[model samples]
Target chain A: MLAAPFQAEFDANSQEFSFAGVVRPRSVDEIAHSISMFRNAIEEARGVLYINVKRLAQMNNTAFHAFSRVVLDACRTRSDIRFVVVTSSVVGWTERMFRHLGKIEPQITVEVYDSKFYPGQAFVEDTSFIPILRTQTKMTWRHERKILPRHGMRPGITMADICCGIGDFAVLVRKEFQPARIVALDHSKASLAYARDVASNFGISDIEYSYGDASEMLLEDNQFDLVTCRHSLQIFNQPDLLLKELYRICKPGGRVYITNEKNSHCLGEPRAQSIQWTYNEVARLFAHFEMDVELGPKSRRYLADAGFDDILVESFMVTNQDGDPQDFADIITAWENVYAGEMAVKRGDPPEFIKRFRQGFRDHIFAALHPKGYAGWPIWAASGRKPL
Target chain B: MNAAHRQPAEPKFEPLLQFEMEMGTFLSDWHHCDQLSTYMARMISHNRTDPLRHSNFFSSALNELLEVSFRGGSPEGRIGCAVYRHGPKERVKISFPCPAGQRQFFREAVARTHGNDAYARYLDALSTDLAPSREVVLLDLAINFDAEIRLEEQDPPSITIVVDLPLEGIVS
Candidate 1:
């Protein structure tokens, strides 16, 4: 079984479970106010050197430390500052700063949470994360503008989400887009089960969860007004065949949105060529189908190519959840759970390298999580659609 | 002019003090009013000899200040403060920062440029352009004046003008 790093690892009989009940705050106004305060604190902490240099590389320690001092100060003021209560970048940066600063202020009990993989950095760019921190602002903006959902919502639109791992988008579709029928398919039964639980809790009746290969789902062509494959397109051993199947299943005037890690590889040295190749191949396949190709932020382009014209791709930021360096330590302790087994198989790295790589990744992640704009994960998002 | 206009016992001036105190409290809470003050200050500094004639910037500033302050608080407070926003019908006194000689020259220039029939021509032009939109309001010219007087040898003489813009057009 993959390790669960960000999650608390239980010893056979431990009495200290009081911390488990920390409910992550979801009020956007509060979060925005907190972030603003955090930003201000970072600006004030002009100089300080405290960071974990595990996973990140070639980072500027001086600036990061200075920045993190401010973040740490803000975290200190907010008594409810749990590891998950802030952006991911802040968590990593703060943990490291706390280790150093906590020594000086021994009274400060900074609970450092471990980084789960490089969780805070965005795997795909999306903006839903902003609402996570600045709820009131996002709500106010919504009320002030007539900004529609990126993809238009047509009542009774039957849709399918292939590889709907955890059903993040499924929940959104049900809540915001109000789709009529949704078939969420994924290969992992555990993940599918989890998705099912969430759908049930959200009271989303239209969604039906099934465990199966996403590419092989039995569906007629032109059956869905919208089909979405988010962050799962690159995992296919046979992406070309999968694309063909997706195209075949979509109805005329119906669009498909596919999101994949750019230049994805299961194992090997990571390179720019890999990311570009993913983009290039996807673009080529869509072009061949006579679909008007609009490629850029992966999800946005995918939607556009599928012929959805009113595609909106808003970018959301992801930071180290811990807001401190202990996040790196967390990454070292939790890499297995964070990336799942595929990361090891894909990297083609030896066990020793993998172990060291994980540790090094955490170190860098810690260093990067420093305060100021200098610390934290960098992430971007894209959403597009097909025409009609 | 000073000898003839001298008010008997300065009319007690108690009402003016009360108005000032109330206005000060309002100004302290209303952040946007500072923007108006800055605008007026700059306008007076730039064209100290004349203020009322430069109604474009002054009016826009006042309008923006009123909008932000009105929306910033409860409707009750806005209604209570409406009188301050829409001043009374008495002659509007706008202070300018220039010497008496400069003010006298400016008034003469205005009179000569327009001639005796110019106010009629101005009134005709003003009536033709009173359309309304979501963005801005139009007002009719009601009063115009130019004056020059030395006050304690420190402040400049000034001109003032007034226009009748319905309260309905000035959205809170």
Candidate 2:
């Protein structure tokens, strides 16, 4: 469902949009069917071979906490596990903590991946906070409604969306900045295929969809003027490694933008401390490497500790406005989908009560969004730059 | 007045309407309602051997009357004994072509069976009946004469209900 055939008739006679490999699921059932199709694909896909503690984090909290305590006790004598991926359901919180982690431990690179179910397949995107990113994007495409792209630029610089999920962000990014090169990376064949189809749909060939890890691939480093990591950390257990890679890959004078919301896994005193420690240690590593740093509001102190000189931290909250009923519904539905998906993935089973729980969540949102109901929260954004 | 010009609704129609309403309420309350239909149906059938004075005899008596009318080639084939217990607690049946649907018909039927106060007292008593006390109740089941309630020891109580029925000539 990810690729499409271009129409020569439209290209020759019409000035409308046309491209290659544009995938469109004919119906909702077809979309649901993709889940199993993706599962079969996963069965064939090779495992990267690492411990997924993030999956453990997805377990029921009470049980997970108890298990962690046992693990910690066991580790008292000897460390048993390393390399963890924490599946974070809460976006802004997750992003904030990861940023903080990056600052304190600039040596580690935490790649955050968001689990998204598109059409009939389930895949994880490099983006961690899907709800907020989708919200900031105006709830278009496979979400609430279709919106015309109107993205603002930071300056003269153009940025690329690496591991772009369905290219919703990439499409808007290309539409606005018309970046010199928009390279998107995703290992999932289906996801990359979909992204490629999306790029073709917009008739934008400048944006490239590559199927490999940016850190591992090392094909183009220090090439782009700007590198942006939005809501895509925590997928890497050794985030410290990622920082070095990002540093190595980006141009000497170029800036690396990393953003995430505060996350639940970054909560509780112990979990919080572990995250803080990771950030500080990495920051010390970065300083030892002689790189100037600027920690945004999300990772302020960590960036400072990471030896990032000339640190600049700014905080802006992306909000779902009070009158935006469509945004409200989309957020609730997406949030429930994410949470429900996490539960299913962790349990190693299909969502048993998805239909029932979805109805319950919808009812709850309708009640919450009525003139009698309103709720809002804040999202944290932070950026760190390399020494010029 | 001729039979065609009676100018009044038939007595049989009221009970049927009441039965339909009761069935609708039963389905709506299935998720949270404690009393199960299987248990209530069995209770009615079990009470058939008892005298009319028995507390559970009402449903059984009505069912028996329906059975005879049905066999006699009457329009009332069988009192479709739709038993439902959902109100606060307690098992209650509203048999139609019957009482509870038509106030006059119910009053007359109850008075004929017992006295003027009999139907009023039973209806009033049912309003304040106790809720079911079982921790877990299964609504759908096929039970037989030899039913067993097995309890397991645990902080939270657990029980298993088993029934034995005749399978051919072999009984275990």
DockQ of 2: 0.00
Report the lDDT of model 1 for residue A248. 55
- Top candidate when judged by TM-score against the true structure: 2
> Going through the candidates in order, what is chain B's TM-score?
0.25, 0.22
Q: Point to the candidate with the largest lDDT.
A: 1
Off by over 4 Å in 1: A1-148, A153-156, A263-317, A320-348, A367-369, A373-388, B1-172
For model 2, the superposed segments whose C-alpha errors exceed 4 Å read A1-136, A139-158, A263-298, A301-307, A341-368, B1-172
Candidate 2 per-residue C-alpha lDDT over A1-388 given as tens digits, one digit per residue, 9 for 90 to 100 = 0111211111112221111111122122333333333333323323221212221111111122222232223224333222122322221122222222222222323445443322112323424444444464553322211111111234345455554555567667565546555656544545555655656776756555544444333223465555655544433333444455455455656655554444321111222343333333323322332322222233555444443444444434333334475675666566555544453344343455444434444553554456554333333344455566
What DockQ, on C-alphas, does every prediction get? Answer: 0.01, 0.00
- Write candidate 2's Cα lDDT for B1-172 as tens digits: 8999787872231111123233234334322121222223234332121111121112222222222212221122122334322211122232323222333332333233334453333323222222200110110001111111222222111111111211111110
Residue B80 error for model 1, in Å?
A: 78
The deviation in Å at residue A77 for candidate 2 is 37
Candidate 2 docks at the CAPRI level of incorrect
The candidate 1 chain A region of ten consecutive residues with least summed lDDT is: A15-24
Q: Residue A342 lDDT in model 2?
A: 55
What fnat does each of the candidate structures reach? 0.00, 0.00
